[model samples]
Target: MRYYLNTQTDPAFNLAAEEYLLKSTNEDCCMLWRNHNTIVVGRNQNTLSQINPEFVQKHDIKVVRRITGGGAVYHDLGNINFTFIKVGEQTKKIDFSAYTRPILEYLNQVSVPARLDGRNDLTVDGLKISGNAQHIHKDRVLHHGTLLFDVNLEMLATVLLVNPEKYRDKAVQSIRSRVTNIRKYLLDHPTVEQFMEDLGRYMQKAYQAVLTRFSDDDLKQINDLAQKRYRQWDWNFGDSPAYDFSRSIRTPGGTIDIRMKVKEGTIQRIRIFGDFFGIDPVSDMEKRLTGCRHDHQSIKKILNAVDIERYIKDVTVDQLLHCMF
Candidate 1:
């Protein structure tokens, strides 16, 4: 097996690298990496429903969707991420234990008392320390997971917090879990970098893996992939499952209610209802929004170009955007 320590902190690049290594290469590989403040959603999840949009925007958190089936997860520099791509028999069944065993063993050797508690979670004293997911392509199985070395638990909770009542969809929802950082369980609290180094060294020795680096060609391809797909809003947010959204807000104008059906990230239908006074019919504004992308910037552009106050009295563009999103 080849071992790689990816030092890049960009979430999109890291995710794209995973795909490149899984599909573009045939070698059995293991990688240890990290990402900056970001939220990675599962492929089948509704991106809007899985994240706190206001908080994410305020903090400038990058949101990307991974090609895996599982719950959404938060990532930061303090966290450690691992990926294992192995070529296996096509008839082999998916096994969580097999992929997670090395992680559990590494944690136990370090006196963390970590154990595989459920299907795909690694827990320490009943609190989750890691969450894992997998993607299988033909004869190759890509298994990746996160290790909470010293992640910001507060930020993770705040960014992932969502109003469940706002969206009605069939998309898979993440199950919130009680989590703790591994640094807290260690006798001598080590920095996340040190922890990552120790873990990588252990894996190298355990598997007799060759430590390698990405060639310039490999990086160019990964960066190209990131720009083409991982950084695009269409793949990250537009690919979400179709859903119905409704939000009501009280403003200086009055109580405004916005309801819409979104498919392929485009608003297929929309209706605006409010007790505010207006000279023009609100139906006209709804018609303009029917074909717009269900995105903050897209809707804001349309709202700014029109005389929004004519349809909803005393409501500023920002206030109306709050209701629409």
Candidate 2:
């Protein structure tokens, strides 16, 4: 028998749900729900290459890589995320079309007017509103998708760069045309909670399985899984692709040049130098930064733990941090 779980928006929780479903041995299927206000890239994507580092640093946003295969996507509270999991039978090849058919059927029943276009997108009219990806385990398959309802379109485009101008000028179309929000078309689309309720009811009817809330045991298991893997740097960013990153930031003090070679989202090497002044020891900061996970908070925390005046001669903490990323 399958189960249905309504999860929270925290990336930690959604990732835990993915882990649980893929690890389960029973031949069952389920739906995992969540929403996020961040950027999520596929497992195979190069984090440094897929995103605009300057934009992300300016906005104080997060970027995480999921254990799935697909292009990058932006998620906000206005979006709805769904994950469908099923343990496949070894005797037969997995039929992705058959698995996603119920989703198309449910949307039609709800008057949402959606169609499965190409391999994994749900489109209405000619615009894409949903992008989905899959990850298969030993015998389990997980299909997760982002449902754009009222997501901030401008923010999405600004954060996810189609291609850096320094790269090939392949005549890239703007992301605005690539993704559309359901609120643009649905006059009375309900809130995420209400939509989830309706979706659960509809899915129960479609799959002919009782919709049961997650139990105490299930919640505990998911929580443990999240702490052990999902929230860890090793799984979220450390496995992303390697790339060279170079960015410049102008602080109140002066301009700083930040160059880094990142492998799997980990800071393999970093060199920070600029016209700004700092009191902390350059050697100490460089050593601390080289092996740490490439995250804003983590880097800041490491800097805080050290004596600021030993290396930098006169730069303020804020100025130094502005240049770190």
- Give TM per candidate: 0.98, 0.78
Candidate 1 C-alpha lDDT tens digits along 1-325: 9998799999999999999999977778999999999999999999999999878999999999999989999999989999999976474566788889999999999898999988899999899999999998989999999999999999999999998999999999999999999999999999999999999999999999999999999999999999999999999999999999999999999999999999989999999887998989999999999999999999999999999778888999999888866
Worst 10 residues of 1 by lDDT: 87-96
Candidate 2's TM-score? 0.78
Model 1, 132: alpha-carbon shift in Å?
0.3
Which 10-residue window of candidate 2 scores lowest in summed lDDT? 165-174
Model 2 bad stretches (over 4 Å): 1-3, 48-64, 91-96, 158-177, 250-255, 272-288, 301-317
**lDDT digits (tens) for residues 119-164 of candidate 2:** 7788998788888777777767777787787889889888887345
Clashing pairs in 2: 277-315, 278-312, 278-313, 279-309, 279-311, 279-312, 279-313, 280-311, 280-312, 281-311
Each prediction's RMSD to truth? 0.9, 4.6
